[model samples]
Target: MNEDITRQLREAAEAHRPDRAQMLARVERGMAGPAVRHRARPFARSGTRVALAGLAAAGVLATGGLAVAAIVAAPSPSPSATVTTPATPSPAVSSPRPTSPRPTPVAPAPATTLGSSRPTPPTTSPSPSAGESQNGPLWSAGSLDSRSTIYWTQSNLALKTTQPLTSLTIEIRIVQTGAVKNTGTWQTLPSDDFTVTVQEADGALVYRWVLKPGRTVPAAGFEFAAQFNNGTAVRSAAGDGYRVDAQGSGGSASVRGGFVPTR
Candidate 1:
């Protein structure tokens, strides 16, 4: 019995055994198919991941070292630039200068002349048709003549107004002459022997006589002087009273008489 069973098993194994070449061809085909390729993708992906993690770690270390070197080597900012320092102002100075003085203007004095201070007095001219003197007397008849007469006991002398007259005045002066060493000297009598009349007429005035008594003429002769004003006429009998002898005894005693108009 055992021998029959063994022969039957061998025939079955031989009949069921697989082909190596055919099995290998099928494995290659499966690998080439979607299912088998999908199962193997995890191994390829795991290898790529490890390589990328290594590269990233190297980049991190290099970047960190460069940053540290820049931090250490860079120059510090200057205090002037960072802190903003303020500017300083400059000081101011002043200077003084000298000045010159201006000149003052002078004014000129006024002109003057000599001998111009005093003024001249005025004079009047007399009328020519009146038959009067061209140069009038300096004083009036009343100023030059007297109204009183003197008297003496030895002779009676008189001055008389013998007619009516207007604006009349008379002046009389007595003179005496004597022989001394044969040289005749004539002198006016003293004021006691003279008479003066000063009269002004409203219309006319008349007088009969006025007398003066005097001593007789001695060895010395005598002379008389008479003057009258305007519009006066005396009596012919009184003419002797106005006259003095022009020729005296032996020419020793002489007289000169005349009429002079008042101014």
Candidate 2:
């Protein structure tokens, strides 16, 4: 047929023949297995390693005895790392000082009574008695009598009472300035025990006194007076005034005033 197909491809190319010396010994053992695993990791030929931390200073690389090159000086932080020192001072204590007591020396009183009158000086008492009354415990005082004559003028009041008065009155007034009438009125209390009067009213000269009915009033200091005339050389009893009202046995009192002006 084409010479038996060219003799069956030359007998299958002489029955397979490709050994080239065993494929060049298996490609030289696969390139000597990565060059013996890269020379067994001999620092892998160090020339680029820098993983630093603190205090280290290596050097070595003039270049190439196997081409290594380390200039590591990278780590530095500890110039005295954190130095500290200085501390000292403590001492000061002083407390405790308090003592008081000493006063005893009196030997002269032993002559006790050679004249013992010095001790009699301890007798105090009797204090309260000021005037101007309003409700009870009475005491009074009014004035204007220097024998007052810049034309007449009398006025006086006095009163005192501390317990026996079954009701009383007194009045007095005056104020009218020029030739003011009413020239008399008086009382140390019993003129028949009160009920006196003088009159003229409102622009003034009043007088009054009153107490008669079984009449009582006796405790002490009495006086009452009035007398008038007033032709002024200096007579401004500034609206005169006097009022009294008593009722006692220690109770209702009322004193009032206004006539002062006697030099």
Candidate 3:
């Protein structure tokens, strides 16, 4: 999978659809207060400057060796509709920018590294005094791109540990390598509704968007297109993002910074 890391994972999957449509267009143009504290840090710094321009175009597509044709492909999720979620234990924010702006456009350098496994960097809860009543929906980005295969799943739960809540699910899948078309399975459901950390407007960062028990819309967005080889963990540019949800489920979500590059 090297065609410049599949074109920098297709420009980090189209730069997360315009950095999530400019954070839903700045929450419908209200300025969204500092864009919600740098929402996903400019789409994780434009997904590491387009993944370092896909490692400098993977050295000119690996010296013009290129291999990995079969463009356009992302659809595979029907294995009896699965989608599970109920692990818990993970929270610490930071790392997820490039939802838009600029600084996220490059493609003339190489020095990559990012082999998954860096999340886990968010902690600092405090707020729940006035009459007490807060839970869920602080950060929950769903995914399930389609075409032939491509699935994703994300949850930060916002360093949870309050106690007294319920409902949570986050699942994703996408399998399809060969066999023209006659052997498939694993297309689960239950996509959103973590509860949105109960409105989340204060300091922000308390999310929820679960749905895996039976699903009614499971597949959400971002199907395939991701790469990060070489050493990995590029100086913790952006880390923290892995929380299942459960255990009294008080709810929370806050990952302030973002950025991850190495290869």
Best by lDDT: 2
lDDT of 2: 0.59
Q: Write the per-residue lDDT of candidate 3 for residues 124-169, one digit (tens) a residue.
A: 2223321122234332332111111122112212222233234443
lDDT of 2 by residue, 1-263 (tens): 97675555445444444444655565566446553444435464342232111101111111211122111222445587565665665666667676666667765532112212121111111122322344566777676655455666666777777688888888878877657766566665567877787888677778888888877877776677677666646677867878887787767878786666544
Candidate 1 regions off by >4 Å? Answer: 1-41, 81-263
Give candidate 2's TM-score: 0.24
Highest-scoring model, TM-score: 2
lDDT of 1 by residue, 1-263 (tens): 97676555545444443444664565466357464344448878787577556545545544544554454456766677476667766665656666667767666422111111121111121122211211111111111112211210001112222221222222322222111011111113343433333232332221112113442232232222222222122211122112222121233221123222223
**TM-scores, one per candidate:** 0.18, 0.24, 0.16
lDDT of 2 at 163: 80
Runs in model 3 deviating more than 4 A are 1-204, 212-239, 246-259
Q: Higher-TM-score candidate among 1 and 2?
A: 2
Local distance difference test, each candidate: 0.29, 0.59, 0.31
Better candidate number, 2 or 3, judged by lDDT? 2
**For residue 246, what is the lDDT in candidate 3?**
38
